[model samples]
Target: MIEEPPTTTQRSAEVERRRAGELARPLTRPAGPIAVYDTVTDGMTGWQFLRTGRWLAYTAAAILFAIICLFLANWQFDRGQQASADNAVVAANFSAEPVPIELALPTLGSYDASQNWQRVSVTGVYLANEELVVRNRSNSGTNGFEVVTPLQLSDGSVFLVDRGWVQPSPTDALNPDSIPRPTSGTVSVVVQLRPSEAPLGTGSTTGNQIQSITLPRIQQTTGGDLYTGAYGLLNSQAPAAEAGLTNTQTSMPVEDVGTHISYMVQWLFFALLGFFALGLAARKVHRELNSDDPEERERASARMRKRARKPFTDEELEDEEIDGFLPLTRWGLSSGTGTGSVAGKTVGPTAAPRVVSPAAPRMALKQDDDAGDREQGD
Candidate 1:
């Protein structure tokens, strides 16, 4: 007697069991321990790039870059805030009442920014021979030099006075045609107090030409107890009118917050972009190392090999492409040998066996040309 085929219910139960078995399997393979190889000796391998150590390196580099960006952003923000504060101070004190020269100058130590731009008056004799010209100072877009003269006070102290600006001689930068001489004898001069200049790099000094106006530098050239800060001549009383000098205009520093803000924003953006790029790289490597599907894993590996500019190993070379789908083996009704069809038929002793050949290389599927032609003709 022929045995009855499986009922619908039984087939449904079997399909469910098969599905559950598949689901029970791991979705991805486990990544084994990292392998160490000498990049200089053996060169980098596919395994080295997919290894855990490389991922760790990627993560570390990304974090370091982000940290540096954050530091730069904070630094720019601080500079912007400082600039704003300095601009505010200049606006408030530019036109304030003048103070006594003694009150503005420090008696012994350094003076702070609070004394900057305070108009003051000093009565002293101009040490004309000791006057030094500050190089590279400009006025009204004209290249010039600042004439810094030493003022001898009655109490036996000397102060450096930034008398005014003068045009450099056409022949020499050091020798100017003439610098306005402060009136001879003890004369009272009204001036604006400014903080002492920070000393700069050492350079060759001839006669009175100097790079900057710091107290220590001036003392090295002309020994005396000079004021810690210098004065900008707002008005000067002289014995005789001097030629070839121009009064200097002291403009306040500009408040530029927008440029710093833009820099801060750009740095933060770079950090975020770097982090995202690292994440993408990690994911791609992870897929290459761990995907459970054989085809998908192989594809991922091929991509990595291409990206790293590495050739395939001997074992990994394949002439035939991977087939996406497996052939249908058999139906439950019969063995179905020799391409025989068992449409709604019960399996019995007379049932035929079907033999399937090994799968061939994958090729692009196309419709029959004859069938297409017939359709077109119709």
Candidate 2:
């Protein structure tokens, strides 16, 4: 009696069984620069693997990455701390009862960071001719200049007062269109204290224009005992100026401790994540190479293989179709083979045929052969 050639269904079933068996087989050592292996199988214990050159290199890389992350986190933490300190100062001084300027600044040009935004009262005469405009000032997002006028106090001392901001001329961007003159003669002003800005050392100061509210720079022209440590943002003027410009005082510093805290936390998490990932990868390598149970070893190998496998591309699929090969479908069967019986049931072609590369099976067979040879030699 002669047996008929196995039907397409039987051939497919046999292919599947062989494929499953191949996947279930333990993997031999892979050949590559970054290949992972079982420590015990390679005649090394867990501790031995940790001491290997490759693992040490991996550990060093993780340490370097963690160090960078930690540095950034530390920088952000410092920034957050500084922001909190600034908010505290603003909260303490922004709305406090007005104090005499003499009390706030006991000596000439004496001011403290703690006194920032402190309301102060000063009686002096406004010297309009000696007024200067601070260049590159911004008011409500519009580029402008701040009008800084000298206030001569009772004791022959001078205090700089930033009256307000005025827009530059429409034609000439460098100069103000018109500076609203401060209240002429003696006036009592209520203002918020602010640190004197440093000289910019750039920009043309030819006319009554200066790059910053630097007292030393302004003292050269005014010639008197000047308050060099700090100036004031005009809050209100007794017998207010006939015409006033837009106030240039900045809004209160926000109390919120922004995203720095969150970012710092995230960086810390990332540092830990890097170590966790390395440990997980090491554990997977140990199971794949050192596990005594063949099934466990096979499963680990299968998982690694699946992760390493690249998905088929459209161009590759087209090339297979051009080569006249039946492409494998999702069900691991030939597509569009026309009325083929599947598991004792006739099925219609629903998709175009796809090609199944022979390279994978060939590689599996080669690995198995190599393992057998190694075992025999042992």
Candidate 3:
């Protein structure tokens, strides 16, 4: 029988076509995050992922991510609600012909949250010489500075006016002189939205020395109260074109209502995920933790502890005997003189009772014979 040639994966048309398609396609959101390998599914796709402990981790992480995603969606929704409310008030305040500048200022103390977008007008002395430009700001893929001209109101209150972004140099972002220098003079000013800033946390960077304009690093350096939120994000009408600097306005951010509700959902999801992941890890080791059959483990542990505390014994050493003095040979005694007695008398010192290993049985036999001889004599 003849067999066809085995081909490399790249050589196969189907594989090549699939790879090419994947390479050609732009990444977009799919129906679900877990559906990426749908073609590989033969009813065991889930089980395969479940086999690795990583799957449990992924599951936990996914729950956390899901909570985040949901929360963001909800938070985004809340923002939309806020924005809508603001828009309505802004519409009401804005429609009335521009009020003279001073009326807007004294009304701030009495303002309500519903009137967040209340229009403010001021007859101000412009500190145009103090043109503070926030540097390294990029808008619409073009690098520029957000020019903030500090408006000194007739009442002596200082407010920052975010004029707009301007390209200081055609290619470079660093042309302070190229920026249209504001001519310092008193002028009627109008602002619909006044925003506030948050503290920059332990930020480190070389920042533009401009006084009013705020960025994260700049906020840390100059610790000042900036805007509550970004304004003129509507880009609906241009005060600049009305004032004549000639540049395209920045595009407004999407007015999405789903963000806050989404964020809350996301946080809730995270909490749930934390629970689920801990559960899986708990499950993996549960039987061992709660086992009733623990004799072997306990015994091993006990033995180890006993061995650690054991004391030394003395059986490994030998007993030593020290000779009191020189033997007959060493004392230079003649052989005949040293036979069981010294100087034809008992030794100078009394001897200890001998433990007669060699002649013990013979000594006993002699004692028995002496007893028999006494009996016979009797």
* Number of the predicted model whose TM-score against the real structure is largest: 2
Report the C-alpha displacement of residue 182, candidate 3, in angstroms: 2.0
Q: Which stretches of candidate 1 lie over 4 Å from their true place?
A: 1-51, 140-142, 233-243, 283-378
CA lDDT of every candidate: 0.59, 0.70, 0.43
lDDT of 1 by residue, 1-378 (tens): 555755657544544332122112222323222223445324433445535565677778999999999999999999889877777776766677666666776584556676656677777898888888888787888777888888888888887777788887888866665666666876777777677679765878677788887777677657667675564555545444365566675565567889998999999999999989987875555454444445654454344334323333333223212431122122222122211112332222222121111222112111122444588789
Best by lDDT: 2
Judged by lDDT relative to the true structure, which candidate is superior, 2 or 3? 2
lDDT tens string, model 2, 249-299?
657767567788988999999999889988997776665445555565445
- Select the stronger candidate by TM-score from 1 and 2: 2
How are the candidates ranked when ordered by TM-score, highest leading? 2, 1, 3
In model 3, where do residues sit more than 4 Å from their true spots?
1-96, 99-102, 107-117, 175-177, 199-254, 258-378
The alpha-carbon RMSD values of the candidates against the true structure, listed in the order shown, are: 15.6, 10.1, 33.3
Candidate 2 yields a Cα-based lDDT of 0.70
Model 3: per-residue lDDT, tens digit, 244-337? Answer: 2333343222344455556656666666667676668644433233222355334433443344233322321111012211222111121121
